[model samples]
Target: MKLILKACIILIILSNTAIAQRLYNTSEKLWKPQKDEAFLQEIATTIPTNEPVVSVAETNETCFALMSGNIYALKSGKLNKDNSAPAGVTELKNKNGDIWALTDNGIFRFQNDRWKKIDDKKYVDLCMHAGKLHAATSEEIYRLEGDRFVTTKPENGYYSSNMTMLMEDGTQLHDDPVRLGPISKIESYSGTLYVLRPGKLVLFDGLIVNEDFIDWGLLPSKNTRDMLSFGRRLFISTDRGMGVLQGAALKTIKGEEGLPVENTTCLERGFDQDIWIGTERGAVRMLKDEWHYFGADMWLPDNKVNDIAVGNNVVYIATEGGLGVINFEPFTLQKKADFFERHLEEWGHKRLGFIHTVYQKDGEWVREISDNDGGHTAPYLAAMCYKYAVTGDPEARKEAVESFNAMLFLEKVSPIDGFFARSIWSTTGDKDEMGRHGSGGLPAKWYKTADGKWYWKGDTSSDEVTAHFYSVSLFHDLVAKGKEKEMAKQHLEKIAAYIIDCGYTLHDMDGKPTRWGRWDPEYLLRPYGYVDRGVNGLEALTFMQTAYNLTNNKKFDDSYNQLIKWGYAANTIRQKNVFPPENLAPWDDNLAFESYYTLLRYEENPALRSTYLRSLERTWEVKRMEHISWFNFAYGAITGNDCDLEQSIKHLREWHLEPIEYNFRNSHRDDLFVEPGYTSYEGGLKAISPREKNITRGSRNAVALDGGQNGRRIMEPTGFIRDYWMARYHGFLEAPETNDPELTSVKRRTEQQFGAEPYKGLEKPVFY
Candidate 1:
């Protein structure tokens, strides 16, 4: 009933809103506060007490955050007590040889070791932009001219008190009705004034220069979080995570690359171009593309760094405990990488595998390289190889590819009739006992014997057919371009045959002949064990599409259509039919698989194309609003149309720290936890258990297991699904022209290098 109602609501909204208008619906919804009184109360109290002291300017030295509201100038790490300023200090500037500080009460100047306070009634924040000292307040903005502060608003439209200055010049200039209701705070950056209002971020590019403008909502935290300008963009720290504003969009960087602490106190620009983020848990410094944590180990006094300021080579941090100073320096990538490698090796290198059914040692079947219990090892190795490829390191690529080749020899039989065995070690590579090898059949399990013979077990279901299809498709692509052409061809043929059989039968695991396909066990449905058909259908379509590209067989095209029909059925069911609340498939999840294949195979379908654009917008909203950790980053990457590469890069960078952990019960001792570095298991932490608790964790035991990790123990279904999705969308795999301008440019350059036409737009070249 819940799923049905939710679907209805979604469909109704979709039907009423125009596409352009629909594009922003998700984002708008995220920015609105929920009605729950408790939640609202929590939000109301979530604001940080400290604001970032971005840059401190003085005539001869830099000013630093001293205590609560107090600031002091420092030269060579020594505080100039005579020039120290009190709380409520708004702006600091250097003019001629004099240091000027603006406050709400008055303006103060320091010279000859003495302080002179100038009685002034108006001042807020101060900055030196476009070669002049400017002060902006909640009411108005002004520029300093020699001995007097002059208003920047135009003389004709300027109002003395209530009127706000949208932009200011050396002289008063008014252009439009200033909307001050939404702006709570403002900062000046590179000739632009950034306004931070609840739920909105408005950028005024020409305070005294160009009149260009752009604005976007901070989707992650609605309007409750604070904003700080660091590097080339604005960073927003909300209850969920941190977000970076790019152009008119806000991209979240959470899970691993983000701070572990939730309540962010302040953000300041460090002297080495690093952004120092202060959170309740610790102080994080990001510089030269690396993030370093200063917490318990550094004697930070308190986890929360209330405010930060940099002077000369010293960094002053204000926290709940007190003020502290430390020498700051830039981080070198080489040194950082070396440090990470040491941590990775210390974590351990155990492998993970799946067993369908186990039996006592027998001579009837033999274990094959493909039948090896470590199912995830190959994909993990492949991911590592891809990483090395990105780094352009020849040695890493060689080692990764070699590992992949070793894993391939484990395949012994075909799981589906038309495809290779689902499990390489199974007697007959069948997931269940229901289907044959060549036609569209159900999933099955395969096992190998020590006597060089293979045996089969379990029920052969359609879900297994689809899983094998996807796995084989990825395997074939990975090896096809290299020297493993024959091996790739073998797997491709098996997958093609399996897909053909499925299209012909129209039957899946439930013993029902329907258009919809079954969900893979690894990619489980919500509320635990319940299975859905969308995943199966989507994977089949993907396989068919890949097959068409590989063989150019019209039969593959027909298969693709059959899969699409199932997709349409699922889509219609999701939109109009009755279902359970937890069962309703998220449009973003469906699009992760559906849109990729549609873009690749069904480019001519106008409805699909139009819906695809809308889907991307929806996906973006989901990512922006949802509290995603490093594990869920794949969802954002796969829905590439919704985000740019910059967001993907941010997520990838975060994963380097918050490594995913996998736990398995050992025979000799307690449960052992293994951590795979950033490249492996991007899907947070997960736990797996043997079907029987009595079974030992040795090589010979029959094990039962499930997987998922959500800051707590989860069953196998969620774990498997997260892993599969993460693998599917890991990194920027399919470089589309629209999504990746850099890759497109690189492709064009490669084409030029080879004297071929550039890979025009999103189309891939046909290899004869």
Candidate 2:
């Protein structure tokens, strides 16, 4: 069952920028430190691209940089391979002349300048013969016999490897059969011998064996660190840079050409023909093709280089803070958007107005603005009340009047009547952190009032009265005007007249029933709030028909005609066709998409618009795989239906969403399939987080990706700014042309006053 076909991507990845270049003007300083490049120091812990250098015969008397068994040297009034060697004096490499070393206890030369053992037994490689010196050791092969190298063997296993040849003589043997170990170099050139192999370096010439002149692109087959050729061009180097192959073209020089350090271990050519290189973070000369770099802010004592021998006049570096030398200079620049606006003020903590979620802990990142602030800051206060009703911006109406006065101080710090607090810390905090932040295990509450001065978080559930009457009816229909719409219609009329004066529920201060904040009519006629009897009687008849359309009152219209004459709106269309999101759970699909937007705010009557169009055609046939742009704009704004507006603008162009509180986890996806249990009207409540990084954009049966709930943080998606300003204040959408804060909030405006052309096919085109 491998389906995954999803197509429709589209992403200009944001760069239209012009609503007066908005990053919210001025006071800009969001952290940006990458402070300029260039410099070196830090000699060891690594640098062994199988020896980026180890010399004696290419003489300057004593040059070394092998690392991983450390050894670095070079100094003579620091002579002139472009001078600079600070942590020098590690020792042994002809400290002042005569150097020759191989050791396992054998071949050690260097006369009048010290070192002497000359060759007695052990050896793994240091051979030249036909011209005097010899030694092999994989199990014997020596031929110096006078100053003594002794024993030998080449009889059956025709030996001699540096990349495989066993040709009886031509000399060489430290094998490589695809790097089965030992074989970092063998060179010879002209008459051809070159073996180097780990990422392709073969050659042979004695009757053809070329290796098609080696290619290996962004260099990396086995750290082919140093290869150089000169003139006919070969270069190679690589810890990811300097490949240059020439002729059939194979270019690569990296660190974006300025070569400050991408790892390159060693490469030498310099004497004015310039090439030098060798780095961890220091020394890169290139010349004529220009690239200087040098690091550790110039004058190395570290910066992990490991080998760079130049000779004719000093140049040695092998660092992990040990032997680095430098005649350096490079460092000056900074502004990767000021390092991404100081990496977004490195994660919040706005204390006293509650922000929390800047998480990291014990090693720091912290934000915990006291966790679960009302089932997640009511979709970030309805995304700052649809960003203060489509940018009438006075800083989005002072962040929607400070998240609507901290959600009207959660029903006025509830001293018992309207109950609401799911967050507020500091009675010196943790006063039982909402008893371990319940998802469905739903317990742990704290009260502590008077003289305690602060600390009030009772279990007023029903997802904070469905995000406080849907973000106070989006701040009383788009950013409150007249005395903030009579102070948000007098706090939604004292939180729905204290839940219709306690008869509907929410009664903490131990007046009982705060658990699951029950709905009225004696808890929906019988089974006492039976799994919250269908979205608690459709969120108490849409909060008393939105407090009887803002106090035309008649006892909030006779408590919405006494919950539609006691049948409680036909038990919310028969407990919404038996809550089938394959049997109910993720907060009963967030109380059936927050009781299907108050049955479309009373779908213009006509018998409650045919039972709210038969409960949104059975909740949009099981919530269209949750590309839930607020249930495709409230079922195309209450039943002109035909949803899937290109999978809700492909979830409003996904765009890496991370505005903080991460932890999304798609149950480690593999496409799909995994039914699992549920249905007892969903009371079992187990599924802790899977449905697309944890649903709750007012959850329409959290479509697939397995029932949710598991440390489900998911902070700011602001449900793509609450389904693009409620699909552009319900015209169903298409008005964007580009003012650019994310393409002027996804510009797209045509549909005329509302749902015209019955939303035919929804335009399409978008592939990323």
lDDT of 2 by residue, 1-768 (tens): 133322211111111112212311223322221112221211111122333233322255455443333333434523122122212212223212334455555556656544457655545444343444434453334556566666433333333233455346765444532221243443344434444555656554333345556544434435776676666566667666667665545577664554545567766666557777766656666777545444332234454565565545345555555454433211111111112112222333233444344444444344443435655566656655654454354665676676677766766666654566776645543312344554356656776656565665676677777777777776776667777788777777777888778887777776787667778666667774565666678878888887777767788888888888887777676555443444455555555665566546533577876785676666555554444567666665555445666546434442222333223322322222212322223322222221123323454333332332222232334445555555544444534433333312222343332111121111211211
Where is model 2 more than 4 Å wrong at Cα?
Answer: 1-184, 187-235, 238-241, 246-250, 257-263, 266-423, 431-768
lDDT of 2 at 549: 79
lDDT of 1 by residue, 1-768 (tens): 999977875664343223213212222211111110110000000111243433244334455333323456554544443344545665454444566666768877766766677647645455555777666655556677876778666545432222254336524444564443244445665456665656555554433322234355445676344567664677877656677777656677664553435456566676667777777665666667545555421224444565565555655565565444555332222222233333223322221123222211232211122222233343334333333433334444454444444334333332233433333322233222322332224333334345534443323334343433334444444323454555555555555664466543333234343332333232223333234433343444556656676677788888767656545324422321114444433332433433242233333455655544454443334333222222233333333333333333332222222222122222221122222321111121212222112212111111122221321211111222222223223432222224332212211122122111111221111222
Q: Estimate each model's TM-score.
A: 0.38, 0.25
Q: Rate the local accuracy (lDDT) of all candidates.
A: 0.41, 0.50
Top-lDDT structure, candidate number:
2
- On a 0 to 100 scale, what is the lDDT of residue 136 in model 1? 61
Model 2: lowest-lDDT 10 consecutive positions: 8-17
